[model samples]
Target: MLYPPLHHWLLGAVGEGRLNWLMLLLAAPVQFGPGLRFYRTGWAALRHRSPDMNTLVMLGTSAAFAYSLAVTLAPQLFPAGSRHVYFEASAVVITLILLGKLFEAIAKGRSSEAMRTLLQLQPATARVQRGAQVQEVPVDAVRLGDLVLVRSGERLPVDGEVVEGRSYVDESMLSGESVPVLKESGANVTGGTVNGTGAFTFRATGVGADMALSRIIRMVEDAQSSRPPIQGLADRVVADFVPLVLAIALVTFLAWLLVGGEAALTNALIHAVAVLIIACPCAMGLATPVSIMVGSGRAAQMGVLFRSGAALEELGEAQVVALDKTGTVTQGQPEVTDVFVDRGWSVVDGEQHLLRLAAAAEASSEHPLARAIERAAAPSPITRQPPSRRSLATAFAPSWTATRLRSARRGSWRG
Candidate 1:
């Protein structure tokens, strides 16, 4: 329908019937060109005894175009008051439906961003130990049981069991634990986890598609392709809706033809076409599948992977969701917040004295709590005297002594 101002302006400028031929010429190609898809699919659906939304669109637009063509080509057949053309109605409906399809395609393209991001996580190469020599090779070239050497501050190339040495691994990406996990001999390590400041060699146990990262990517792909259970209900209703609308349109045509007086033919055709056009099932057919795909993909992007489409649908039914406290609510990194000093010391800078000693004692430790203590004492002006690593066998020693100078402490304690 035209807006009030535009309708009034058009009528004032051109009167009436002056632009009907131009409209008919502009609409003819659109009615038969890309619109051919509707006719082909609609005819197939009707032949199979299961008419669908395509059939309804085809019938509605074709009826409107046929009647408008009749009116435009031979206006004298109808009474002077009933002669009218509706080329715009038929053409506009096809254009709008095509535009909706284009938008749906664009949404499908955008939903794959999560999968692309997941694929980007896997490293391209790995360092493998060959007999007495170490060589770098493609990740896929490393075989099971091959000894893979990983240095400090690097991502693990594949899932494997440690063969020698010790380190702490940050598995927060997969396990949601902020604290770095200890990886001693025989301990298992996963691909994509970052290693702490220690070197280690591990036997490759899972590579290529069998790696944990690859399996997670596969789960995301499966979840995106799967159809949720709710889509079945929509499919059933749409199957029945087309036939119900066709029956109503037939009844409307018969009622108008028998009861309407001089304008019975025009009245029947117009009302019947209106019922079919308004009952198009484009939205009903598209809503369920598109929502499922987009929802699953967006969830993966947010670090929440749905196992399947059913999980995505069932998520709405949950009343209480249990979440991990470390990674979900707080940053996994630990930092010292408060410290208290012993009462009997009577030292002016007792807190700084204790913090410097604590930081030196923990300087060789790889634990997160030790790092937090070190960070807290970093501002103290005193030179930290850390114990020898050769003497300290374990990261957390029961009792270790570090000599502190009283002169270095007088500058400032900024903790």
Candidate 2:
């Protein structure tokens, strides 16, 4: 950090007191601008009878600034030859603290950016039907009971009930359905859904923040803002440590003054200020939370999440292991490769029977297993296309009817 020539230049400037005054000018803004913000916030906290880390920060930086100011203005008032300025100390400390806060704000923003991005996905405008006249207006202007028109290729601006026409709308955000949903008269559609190949007019039931997408965004924001059930030990320590730290700072100043009588007053004062600055406790306070946030974020990216700090601690202590098939032993996306039938069931045409039954039951569902069974029931071995629900119902109806007839015949003979 030391440049040889710059160091020599500083030594000369110190003797002449030129560089010292320049440092004072540099320290002024650091103390009064960003650093003064701490004082304002900390003072507000004190007025409400609740002081925190900000209070400690303000006291530390203030002590350093006051000492540096005294040293700069009156060199003769000090213990002769001990009149050194601490402008650099106070300035660097405050600036670094502010920089840390800037980075923390950015981190928090990124943590909840998903909500903002979702909010932005809704269309900006809507075609509203006010009696006979249809006009394009801002989505915000669309109100409850207003009829909003959506075309073949458009995003719905608000949650509404379809009043006229019919179309397929993609509602992946709400239902996680890959296929577009058919929306006819009386069908409900949500905001942010993409319209498929048809035109429709719907009555707005939920506009503005009342829409499903808006509620989802708010939900995500709240989840990110809520604290976990069990907080880290460090957070509890910091909560109780504030009052103790302030008391220690007062004791430090008085103890130094008593130890170094009158001749060492300047030395005593400088030592006291140094103690306060060193005892700011920012690193101790930030260490646990920062590490947890970063670690949790990384885990979430990998598709894993801990419910709380307590959960993470329990995970660290795990020695014995039992793999549950439902959650812990998944390949993430399940597939239907095999089927099991009970021993009492007839198996003469097991393959065909199972395929028909599965396809028939799953025909109305959009789940992957349903699609897989429907594909397996296709007549052609190479056909990859899924059968329609109507076709599946037609195909399975005859086989099921014959099985019921045979069962009835056996029951009549027994009776």
Candidate 3:
């Protein structure tokens, strides 16, 4: 493109002969350097009698570059207007295709982020009770029936049943529930779920790969690897599509050569190269796999894991999507929307006083409702009192014990 414009600027500073050599110098690296992969794959496919998108790219770009090189080296063989170089054509095509593959690579890397995040959810160590001694051991060392101890604000190491303690467990990781579920003796608790403001001892029933979190991660990975039916059909079509395009290009080259016209050789080669370039099957070969991998990965990021690529493809045809209200619509967190106090209770600060008392009572608990009350009373002045004999008695005593205050409290709740 700079040939005519820049050449006319300095009264033909660079002659056409030198400019042609310059084009060859610049385009040689682009044709063989980064574009070598296409040549190797395309040749291998051809020798195996199975042509693909790479074959089309190799044939088209090679034909254009060869014709241009010949024109530049020996311009006397062709007419004046016929002696044109296509260095930009070959270079641009290869650059664009390589850039596209780079973007596809980036998308593939992004798709694995969700899987990495899910893998991080599993704790590396578990607190196991062994003959009256509680020891922290690698989670992989934990065996079925082992007693696992989970404390407040800790994630369960494996699926188990509560054998000896009472607590509220935040199972929102699996169930998407806004409120923590109460766990007691014989209640089943899953791994990866967080414990509330109480401690509990449970017998591990599912360890290692058998855990629910592991199964979920495996499902997401399988979905990413599984091929959709449409991709198989596309592969079949592309297998035949390449040969058909080659046949068409050959027919075009023959027809143009045999017809009576000026510069018939040049026209035949140009038309055939055009046919090859226009018939590239890159979209057909790349579209299905790229979409499946990217869509499944993005869905996993949004907490929607598919079982297989076919399921992901079918999801596109879904007209109505049903979603649960709690986590899906509302954020799955509780808030104190309103305060209700009885007229019989004598309170100096009204709603603020009631909220402060409630926050103090539930301060030791980690349940969603307790957190909500605490947030409501955060702006008000709080009186932090050390644990006294009377307050300790009130904390442990069943009369003053609120249902949400299951955790052991070390301070007084007389705010």
| Preferred candidate (lDDT higher): 1 or 3 | 3
Q: How high is the lDDT of residue 34 in model 2?
A: 80
Q: Write the per-residue lDDT of candidate 1 for residues 1-415, one digit (tens) a residue.
A: 4688986677678765666677788998998997888899988987998776667778778877887777778777766766767778778877766765664455445445666766666678899999999999999899999999999998898999998999999998788888888999999999989999989999999999999999887876676567668766655665687788889999999999999788888778767877876776556545664565477546645667667768878988999999856555567788888888645455567688768777887877888888899889989953456745543323223322221233237564222
lDDT of each: 0.76, 0.70, 0.77
Best by TM-score: 1
lDDT of residue 342 for candidate 1: 46
**How displaced is residue 233 in candidate 2, in Å?**
9.8
Poorest 10 consecutive residues by lDDT, candidate 1:
395-404
Which consecutive 10 residues in model 3 have the weakest lDDT in total? 395-404
Query: Which candidate order results from sorting by lDDT in descending order?
Result: 3, 1, 2
lDDT of 2 by residue, 13-100 (tens): 6763666677889888988988888899877876776766667678777887788778777767887667777777777777666665
TM-score of each: 0.79, 0.63, 0.74
Q: How many backbone clashes does candidate 2 have?
A: 0
**What does candidate 3's lDDT look like per residue over 165-254, in tens digits?**
889988877877668899999999999888887888999999989999999888877765666788677656756877888899999999
